[model samples]
Target: MHRTDGTRSLAGLLALWGATRLVLLLAVFKVYVFPGPDVTSDVLVIYQGWYEVLRTGTFPLDDVTWQYPPAAALPILSPALLSFLDYAHAFFVLALVADLAVLALLLGTGTRPGRTVRGARVWVAGVPLLGPTVYARYDVMVTAVAVAALIAGTRRPRLMGALAGFGALLKVWPALLLIGAVRRRAWAAAAVTAGVLTTLFALAMPGAFAFLTFQRDRGTEVESLGALVFHVARHFGWDGQVLLNYGSVEFLGPYVDAVSTGALALTGIAFGWLLLWRMTATRFLPHTLADAAFVAVLMFTTTSRVISPQYMVWLVGLAAVCLCFRRTGMRVPAALVLSASCVTMLEFPLWFSHVVASDPLGVTLLFVRNGLLVLATLVAARRLWRTTVARPRPGTPRGSAGEREGASHADADPQGLPDAADPPGLPDADPRGGPLSGARRGLTSRASRGAG
Candidate 1:
């Protein structure tokens, strides 16, 4: 009966994914027109232009809008693999392939014993909520690499680090995926892989590192959290202009720099808080890696100066990984992110003109979307801190200190249940900050050995 139910759920998930992805493909392919703007224009024009330049063995040195990392050239040039199709069509096809790859990985991992298929559901639902924009951008491809890295991190630390390192070079945000990693092998492998790639790219491509200076004067994008200030200010005759700056719709007049600075400061504060969490954290459960990665990415994304619609893809992928471990407490934040993605689609390729004009509809969408992201970040951060930080309460019973110390790990199994059913007469973790032993140690070893 259990196997039959699981098979039915899998069938439903696949059907939904296929149906939604078919709609996305049709919209991007222009068989059906999506509202507001042509999201596929970027792929047809900007990405294709970059591909032409990259094929000549150099970066787009003259394009200020080419503000991505050096390794971004791979995805732009990836269309050559599908030589039969035009650049735009090939790019969309590759993007769809990457999307399918993520689903396959999530399904392979989420169906294991003690794990649940909730993560796959999150991905299947969240991607479509953002509309066809998911396939028109290379963020989906980058997200696939990050997801694979996180899944590999459970039992293959070296592989996780290597993938994370490669992913960071593709886009900068994947570097945060390693924030929760406890094994030293993951960090070391990441460093070596990144170092080698950096050297290789610098030697192989001219202006490979030029992207570092591309965003020196970027403003707060209209879709970002900081842009809310300008959107409201526009109604009061603040004399600000919304312009296409650095490839995004941004506020570029009175006091724009101030808000941008504030966003940067918030990002700094977020990093400091993450550092504190890492240093003070004690419990290292199987889900902690994914949980920490999800929290770290959420914090940075919410506080960024530019919150593009595609940024939500990264969050969805990470949230899926977090949910793969049924014991994870990130369900609320994942739901919040899903809600934010829907609003993002409306603000982007749907009602984008209103956003640029700072009209009521656009302003309301931005507020709700950014507010959801902020709430999700705070909730996720709090959960991560509470579960990992060792907080001994005052006047606690001395006899129960051992139990309290290991309470955080009690419900970290793949089934989201307490590990109290471990083999009898075996002890849990040591109360004095020593190593785990007995059945508890065996359970952790087993959990750590799996892909959960």
Candidate 2:
């Protein structure tokens, strides 16, 4: 029987959660989520090398054939320990664990103080398990570690920093979040983490140090959000290599010759100067750091020439991080980003070939997909513009700490969320001493803003 108010029992919801889980588990064996070659990409080559390295008792050199950093090598090396098992089967098992690790990070945040990413934990845990990208790359291992670090950062800065440091050793992106800590106490956490991570690399394998020098030569050909547009333009008539200059857009497309390089050079310096100014000017706080990083990564994506589908996972993951923070305005955008990603990524490989073969329909799909993203971005920006910060209640006492730069919507008012009248971005509402002040006493996890 249904209740008048429409809230379901915990038993009912959990039963539903379990039924979905059962269907997914059965589908994996019933259908091949991780199909052998023909469907996989070169990202797995690292996993292949790890199996070889374990058998030989040495770290394998990434001579073009294998090009990931040594930290990422650990996950691949994991399968090597299973010497008796078939390497393909080992790769599958590790992927399954990686899927589970995403869940672990999501669940790990349950005890945490912020608003949950609504249904994010459910979709993240479920969808990646069923998708082709799960099998295409061994990225999940490092990605999961990085996510765990982001979530844990609010509760335990040191633990969060350590997890991030270890993940940075595995993948370069995790190091970027350290910028969030700024010169505050969180910086201490980052420093200790860097020390621990360096020690690990130094003690276990001297070779890992040399891997950094080698990585500079092996730069990204395709990455960033802009890669999609660049590829489409090239598919038409555009030419020239796409590059990043100071973490922003510096276009070279309109020109196809030597003039393009100079244009790119100018673009890079302008963007670099802007990034430096923003970093120097903005005060560090969880909300600001999270929002800036999400946007910054998009800047990278918008300007890159090569955008692999798997790269979308990184953005979606970071967007999820933004949502978990106290910012309710970002949750809806995060939701759309997640939903669209599932559709785009799942359809890309499976339907891309058929669409290409069909030609006309593929063109239609491209139009609809790209057009939707452009429209969605506009809508998100509009919502962000209207969110004005709320005022403190009349009797609310003056806090011991100074107010943070970005004002939060969560004032003494009962409305309890960011809106058109509220501030446009993440509020630096947190004063350095806000926690100790009785005015903000009942506020739960400083990061987990209660999402409506």
Candidate 3:
């Protein structure tokens, strides 16, 4: 592990940065820039809207098509603006901005160590969109709001919520982050976000709430992780196809059976409640929030009946934010998680078909990718668990969330200098998980003054 003593040479850090960049560039070109799925990812869906425009007066609405929230519909005009130019040119412009938005948000938190460089390296994942697949899709737009929420979440939490609210309008993932607000102040921040976005949703799309109801009546698909459990029954040639509920592969093998989804929902809620109650009552603070937020993403990703290829885009955005405000002690482990995400994208976006046909190549690649992430998750979980079990830092026998904000009050810098353990905001930059709340042991002898 790199020492907190800051003794590592800058050259070594830069070398690491350069290597990671090379990997990202290769991944981008392999997946997006070159001929492959990237050709179709974004263009097919977004261009469909234009088809609707030609047939009807406006884009398709009140339909099960995109399954997107109303707010997400607003950004389509970003590409539409280019109709005066060329529609293709407009798509490219929107794609570039959306892609860069992620990079900008990552680099915007410049004070955190390596955030800019690591951010720049991580930013390459978006490059694949230059390929037709991603460029045409709205994934980048969702990433923009998710990244914005992460960047804004550092200190101005209300800002975080608002950005998340905007994202929620697009894809519905950011809405889950609202559960992270435990403190009354955090609730205030989230409420402000709700108030602002809700007013806009009402004004712009008066019947938007009806869409939510419409979504509930919809059926599920077979692509989600939850459906994996039901695959065996299908393999056995169970004839419950039309008899099952809308969701894929119901355990009960009946259309009337909602038990699989219902049970999963109850367990998810219980798990979330336990994390919040156990961590707060025990005063475990920010690490709990970070871990919990990551789990929330996992739950959604795993539970959804449809895990599209584009879903990885959401994880990429949130994961970067997680690394930005990482537990100072978990740096290496966090990097490993990033490496796994990076490698997985390589297989998923670029080499997917080749992998499926080349069974050994595919399985080996999957092992390397998921294995690394599992290693990182274990390490991060250990760090969080240790913190929850360990003694308080010396000189600070007790602490409060408000106390975590006090250091920023004294620091004149706008970046919100890091707390005693690491650079300010460095450990709390998670998008939906919330911010770090801790106190330093030696503030009077401080030398650091940036986010990292």
Best by TM-score: 1
Question: Which residue runs does candidate 3 get wrong by more than 4 Å?
Answer: 1-42, 45-47, 50-62, 110-116, 125-133, 178-186, 218-220, 240-267, 270-292, 326-415, 419-452
lDDT of each: 0.86, 0.49, 0.50
Tens digit of lDDT per residue, candidate 2, span 56-172?
644555443344456666776676667686665566566656656665555444324344534345435435433555544666666677667666655466676777777767766
Query: Where does candidate 3 have its weakest 10-residue lDDT segment?
Result: 242-251
Work out the TM-score per prediction: 0.91, 0.65, 0.65
For candidate 1, which ten residues in a row score worst on lDDT?
Answer: 411-420
Model 1 misplaced stretches (Cα beyond 4 Å): 393-452
What are the per-model C-alpha RMSD values against the true structure? 4.2, 8.2, 7.7
lDDT of 1: 0.86
In what order do the candidates fall by TM-score, top score first? 1, 3, 2
| Per-residue lDDT of candidate 1, residues 179-298 (tens digit) | 988777889999998899989989999998888888776889989999999889888889988888889888888898899999999999999999999877766666888999999999
User: Judged by lDDT, which candidate is best?
Assistant: 1
Judge candidate 1 at residue 347 and give its lDDT. Answer: 90
lDDT of 3 by residue, 16-65 (tens): 54454444334333442553444443444445453454234333454444
| TM-score, cand. 3 | 0.65
